[model samples]
Target: MQYYARIDRSCIRPAKDRQVTKRTAAEMDISSSIDNETTHKARSEGATRLNSLVASIYIFRLLFLAVCAAVRIQLDNGRYLVVFKGYPFYEKRAVRKGTAVICSCTRAQCNSYIHVDRDLNVVHEEIHHSHEPTRLIPLSNGRYCRSSNLPQMEFIEMANGKVCLYIDRYTFYQRSPRVWYCTNNVKCRSYTALSPDMRPLRMKIDHCHPPPKLLLNIFMTQRGKERLVYHDYTYYKQSRTRNGFRWGCTKNRWHRCKAYLHLADDLTIVRSNMEHTHSPHGTPLYK
Candidate 1:
């Protein structure tokens, strides 16, 4: 009864031996590798989120600056409106010679009206009417003067789109001539005097002088062929007699007329027979 059955000794191994210890070591190594991989992935995700946050901050700052600029403009507009409303309304004056006033808004829709003060008030004029109409004329000293109590003046438009005012020496009598006086109050830079002889000392020209610089040498192109030929000029008076002529060393031609001769960018003769003309109307020689 005390006898035990024969047991296989190899079937049971020690649980605390080196074979169990080796298996545990392998599992620990695997777990450590997995944990390192997870930590690297988390760090990459965190970097991407930080970049997004920085971009959003930069955009927000830009929007704030734009809003500030808009607010400043609105405040300035409000101030201007207040100033416009405070100005005095119109008190009527007779529209006579030498009388000038800043007439408020001409549009029918607006009730705003303000009479502009003249540069100088007439000291000895009747309230009802003026003796003679204001005359705009140039003084003998080459200055412009306005005589009317309502000195009506305008900028004379020249053919070349330039403008000039007729101001005589008498304009210096005005207190605020710089602000009140102008060719129609547009502010004039230069003025001209009317000459009794009706001849101008100088005239305005549309063309600029010292002449344009030649861009390139003159070469004749005809029938898809070009030859280096010298040019010439010829000028004839009413009698059809040649008075002036020039020789072209490069093109080997004679230049006759300074007005008709066509020059290259280098000022050399290009064509002799072709008439030189400007845009629009062909202006003859001006004095």
Candidate 2:
């Protein structure tokens, strides 16, 4: 004998109800996907805005730096001078009802001028320069000053008894009574002016080439005599020839050194035998 169990039809869910529940879950998934897409789009837009802001700030900084480098102010002789592009300009007068100031180039021969507002902004300018830009040198006090104030020129005596002006390691020969031009005049435009008492007044332009290597010089002895200076050696006039003069090393009398050289009339080395019996004098220059 077997017993049969009966099922309640009201307790089981219908097919229509099950399909409605599945549709509700699918709708929630779609809504969540839309929300995620919106969040991603917002983040991307925020990143773009931040990059644009950073770029704008960098450009502003570069503009400010360019302006600063283009203009400079300096105090000269209790007066203010405007230094623009390495050229100094003096205040000539005020124009535009005192709203703008007219500045002329400090160099007397230069006719360049500029009109600047009260805030040092250039309004009008004429950039015709007759000379090269002024050169500035750094001072010990961390300030920059004109190189004209410091006249540290050196005088060099050549082997031919001619004097040359040495400044900043470049050699300049005398062109006139008061002017000295660079040795390499064809390629270099550097020159130096002198005062009445043989003092350096001003120097113009920079050297376009390297300094020349000087291996020979002439030195004056204590007894009003001249000596030919070689590398760490002093030579005395031994004999006079038809073409040139012969020089023997000064150590010949003491150490029997046989170093000798023949110099032409133009003070050029014609022949030389630099073998010495002893060590060199070891002096850079003879007094």
TM, every model: 0.20, 0.38
lDDT of 2 by residue, 21-89 (tens): 899999999999999999999999999999999999999998865654335555333456787766889
lDDT of 2: 0.75
**Cα-based RMSD of candidate 2:** 16.6
Per-residue alpha-carbon lDDT of model 1 for 1-287, expressed as tens digits?
A: 59889999887778777688888899999999989988988998898789989989988987754432111011111221101122212234535553644333322344544333353222222122212322323333433223332222223322344433322211211113232222322333232332344223321111222221212222322233221222221122111113323322221122222344444435455555444332112223333
lDDT of each: 0.34, 0.75
